[model samples]
Target: MSVTAPSLPAELAARRGSTVELRGLVRDFGGGVGLTGLDLAAGPGEFIALLGPSGCGKTTALRALAGLERVDGGSILVDGRDVTGEPASRRDLGMVFQSYSLFPHLDSAQNVEFGLRMRKVPAAERRRRAAEALELVGLGGHGARYAHQLSGGQQQRVALARALVTEPRVLLLDEPLSALDAKVRVQLRDEIRRIQTELGITTFFVTHDQEEALAVADRVAVMRAGAIEQIGSPEELYHRPATAFVAEFVGLTNRVPGMVAGGVLSLLGAPVPLAAPSADGPVTAYVRPEDVLLAAEGVPATVLTTSFLGAVRRTRVRLEDGTELAVQHGTREHPAPGERVGVALAPTPVTVAPAV
Candidate 1:
């Protein structure tokens, strides 16, 4: 599968928040600004990821959408309806935080039923809904367990059940899996996607993990400072990054500083043609690690390092100028660091971003 990058549109803000549009949403706390005129959108049932570094306003956006953080300007909308001034209790939204946010005093079933109970649903119906929500998260038999009796993943599952039980109009997640273990995180990642697909609820997930976002989200919005850097499908963001930041952040990439002339790009004095977009200018081309193949006949270099990653081996090589690049190969012929090597790509289109 290939990943496409974002392209500069004729109307930059034309499609802003067409789904879950945020118009000039700004938030500031004392002297520190949390968000600045942020505009974002998510299609119905589309899993959108607000991805960025810590304190880059991803969580702030999710919080603002959940009515936890008040926007100083602009408005918030769900399915094109304004919910900017609506209180959290009045907004038809469900949220899962970085912390599980479960009531330690309540049992698993009780935690999931908390919202239903608050809404004054019939006891029989609330019990039925709580059980169904728990089953949705694969926590079926642990209904009576207290928070202390469940595993971290189980508690988070309970939290997921709680957020989902209300069947809210929109779903917001603030690094909900950040607190889980690696294995559990991967397990729940699939679970969250499955549950979201089953319910078809509009979701905005906040996370600093690129792999998680890329693996879980239909589209990812890479954020910088308080603004969105680029927004596109996982494939688009990975293979066709519009900026150097997205290229470097989305996947394992080897960024070689070079210049493009004509339709061919020259790297370390070698002639190379890109895959898709045609650019004839001075630019830097991006090559993914897996894209770098150890061809039978290519430029010779020395391997700096090699790491085994399950089926593929990631090898780092240094050019004649001591410049280094990484490639993942399938052959088990391990090369020691500093050993002579040769590398080239499979002649696929490459993404280029202007040098900084």
Candidate 2:
């Protein structure tokens, strides 16, 4: 699934990425919350992913930026110019969706040329740009194929070509790879990231898939209740989560009961550092499965189940105190159910919330 970078024409290459700012955006859908004082900023050529659960206002914020949804408050700015009240047609943005949205009758080249045609671009230049766009997506000779003539992945490439042919100031992707199978999703996501990097286009991607967001974006903005819960690089968000919500949402986290005293947490007979300042008291420590290991010398537990997950294996064990923990280790360390094992917590810093 390697994609060779395609060379762009001088005119296309000369385009610089634009800065985008969404300041205190508020979108209310009557009884439902769309957005709540949401604010985000993106530098030129930066890729920011809006990630969260369904109904978390990620899509609403994206639509507002694209002028597809009206905002009740706040302003939208691109390259320092206010465009809050501008129509979608005047936004100079490119967007791709989960659905390919290609015209049924039009071939790949015609579909890619649709945007140029809408702007009344000359037919000769439109054909040249369309051909180049298709080439850019690694479908150089597939321009004559129709929607039915292409696979899901190829159709998506054509849709992407159409979106990019306009050389937009900003690119908006709303779960564009959700419909594909697992392998295709991974392949297309990588290709999308590579193409975006080469083009240096400012992008805002909206998706509920954490892995997808973590893999492609320069920064991930995790949304909750119509606002950004946390925004940071993938490593920062995963390794040093600012809050319990982020730790539990960004990855697989085990809620283990522990006592926090003198800025240290005692979990499974191990002293672990706290990632953030917490009041000294009982708390539910958020620990990643990878941070737990099946050590020979630690708290005794009985293995309840084990599951193999490709490169790693996870085993669930119940402690003598009845506390269940998931330990992730190498596949070679397989432990059968009903077997007694010792579980130990790694010395990694952990995020904790008030004891429930």
Best by lDDT: 2
**For candidate 1, what is the lDDT?**
0.81
lDDT of 1 by residue, 1-356 (tens): 11122222222212222257788889887677588889886777789999988878888888888888888998988877898999999887889888887888899999999999999999998998898778778877789999999988888889988998887877888898988889889888888887776667788999999989999898899988788989999889888887777778888888877677666777656666664555666776788888777865766888888888888888899878766789888867688987777776655567776666
Clashing pairs in 2: none
For candidate 2, what is the TM-score? 0.98
Runs off by more than 4 Å, candidate 1: 1-19, 30-33, 268-270, 274-282
TM-score versus the correct structure, for each prediction: 0.90, 0.98
Clashes of 2: 0
Q: How far is candidate 1 from the true structure (C-alpha RMSD, Å)?
A: 7.6
Q: List the residue pairs that clash in candidate 1.
A: 3-239, 4-235, 4-236, 4-240, 5-240, 5-241, 17-21, 275-349, 275-350, 301-341
For candidate 2, what is the lDDT?
A: 0.92
